[model samples]
Target: MSSLSGRTAVAGIGATEFSKKSGRSELRLAAEAVHAALDDAGLSPADVDGMVTYTQDANQEIAVAREVGIGDLSFFSRVHYGGGAACGTVLHAAMAVATGVAGTVVCYRAFNERSGRRFGQPDARLGGEPSSQGLEMSWHVPYGLMTPAAWVAMFARRYMHAYGATSEDFGRVAVAMRRHAATNPAAWFHGRPITLEEHQASRWIVEPLHLLDCCQESDGAVALVVTSAERARDLRRSPAVIRAAAQGSGAGQMMMTSYYRDDMTGLPEMGVVGRRLWEQAGLGPSDVQAAILYDHFTPFVLTQLEELGFCGRGEARDYVAGGGIEIDGRLPVNPHGGQLGEAYIHGMNGIAEAVRQIRGTSVNQVRDVRNVLVTAGTGVPTSGLVLSAG
Candidate 1:
């Protein structure tokens, strides 16, 4: 295992209520979550000296530090690539704590994705800008491949063609996530589990993709406290040890438009992350008690299972169809409802769920959970974590 493995731990986690509208500024949401995390850790803002967040997050680290009553920070950093940066933020905090550059770090993400700026809508300005990202978007926007759903549909269609996978295969993922969510009171879709028939009948957002397959746009924030493993042992809650955290970008990666790769059916970037995580943690797929796979789109969840070596390539449809991913099955996934049934806080909530499982406090707690796997966004430069009990 890497020297960084199990050196630091997530001692606390906190989140705001998931909703379509938070009725507050993103900064305030960030502060509230941070404060709650500190409180959960039995630490005050005065103890925090490091901060990290997504580069695209509207709330700046310094701004959040000030609002939360934190003093001078020794470490503050940000990761790029939208939802792919979720676990990467925790990676940064673990590195800081392990290296003694910072004593305690708080990783957070906050946004008003629903009421303020709906990411589902196409923005024409993305293609007109002069930056490299804009140049990349220019390759597809003019051809009506502007929205995220359209971009993912291209890959989903290819996946279906390559593996003979049907839309029902994808619907199975939604159904499983909703079933777990229905039992989680914190989930937005609590008490609203759907059947396979319901998933099949949901409105189509794009070919091979349904509205139910897409995650909800939510307004909220989630924050986690990271500190040395030894110190974490004395914290208020059971610490979720940082067994491994890694980020990976595959060849020909172009944000979410990584269509140039030879195999559109797989996410090579997540494969890279999975390899590193397993090596670092000295554990394999069977060791994981549960998983919080990023569920931005159901098709990607199937792809992630293959990339993570939970099953062979082109076999996830059968793997999911045979009750392989249920709460009582081989690998229960998204027990907190995931981004689909739960509100999407850009994967931050998913990380919190991983911590909850480790602490034996998850709403849908799996029996004898000692290790939980959490993945970030796919079809982009992505990240993942192997969180184990301390």
Candidate 2:
């Protein structure tokens, strides 16, 4: 295991209500979540010495700290690549705490994506800017590959062709996520589980991708408190020990438009992250009692399972068939409903779910959850974490 492994722990997690419209400012949402996390950890904002968040988040670290009444910060950082930065924020926080650079760090993400700037909508400005990111999108925007669904659809189609998988295979993932969500009162889709047939009949967002296959555009915020493992053991909640945390960017990476890769059938970047996570934790797939794999899109979930070696390549279809990913199955997944059933706080909520499972407080808690695997976004430079009971 790496020197950083088990040195830090997630002692607290907090979130605003998941909703389609959270009528508050993004900054307010951030403050609320951060304050809630500190409260959950039995710490005050004055105790926070560091902060981390996504680059895409509108709330600045200093601004959030000021609003939350936090004092001088010794460390502050932001990660890029949209949802891919979810676990990366925690990774940054863990490193800071492990190295004694900071005593307590609050990692947060807050956005009114649904009520404010919806990421699902295509904007021509993406290709009009002179920045490096605009240059990357220029090649695809002109070809009508605009929205996130469009970008993922191209890869999903290729994956289907390579593996002879059907759309129903993807729908099964949606069904399972919704089923789990139905039981979670905090989920937006609570009490709304759907059948595979319902998924097939859902309107199409893009060819080879149903509306149900895509995650919800949610308005919410989530935050986590990271402190040294020793200190965490003294906190209010059971520490979710940071077993491993890693980020990876594969060759030929081009954001979501990574079609140039020779094989579009898998997420090699996630594979890189997976290998590092297991190595750092000195654990394998069998050690993971549950998984909160990112569900921005259903197709990517299958690729992530394969990338992490839970199954052979192109075998996720059969692996997820029946109730394999349910709470009673071999590997329960997204028991908190995931982005599909829960709100999409850019994979932050998924990490919260992992923590809940480790603490044995999850609504869909699995039995003997010694280790829980949580992954960030796919089809991009992604990150992952292996959280264990402390």
Best-performing candidate as measured by lDDT: 2
Candidate 2 lDDT tens digits, 1-390: 237899999999999999999999999999999988999999999889999999999999999999999999999999999999999999999999988899999999999999999999988688998698899999999988899999999999999999999999999899999999999999999999999999999999999999999999999999999999999999999999999999999999988999888998999999999999999999999999999999999999999999999999999999999988987888999999999999999999999999999999999999999999999988889999999997
lDDT of 2 at 234: 96
Q: In candidate 1, which residue ranges exceed 4 Å CA deviation?
A: none
**What CA RMSD would you report for each candidate?**
1.0, 0.9
lDDT for 103 in candidate 2 is: 95
Q: Which ten residues in a row have the lowest lDDT in candidate 2?
A: 1-10
Which pairs of residues clash in candidate 2, taking residues 3 or more apart in a chain or in different chains?
A: none
Pairs in steric clash, model 1: none
lDDT of 2: 0.95
lDDT of 1 by residue, 1-390 (tens): 237899999998989999998999999999999998999999999999999999989999999998999999999999999899999999999999999999999999999999899888989787998699999999999988887787888899999999999999998898888888899998889999999899889899988798888888999999999999999999899999999999999999998899888889999999999999999999999999999899999999999999999999999999999667878878999888899998899999999999999999988899999999999988778899999997
List, in order, the clash count of every candidate structure.
0, 0
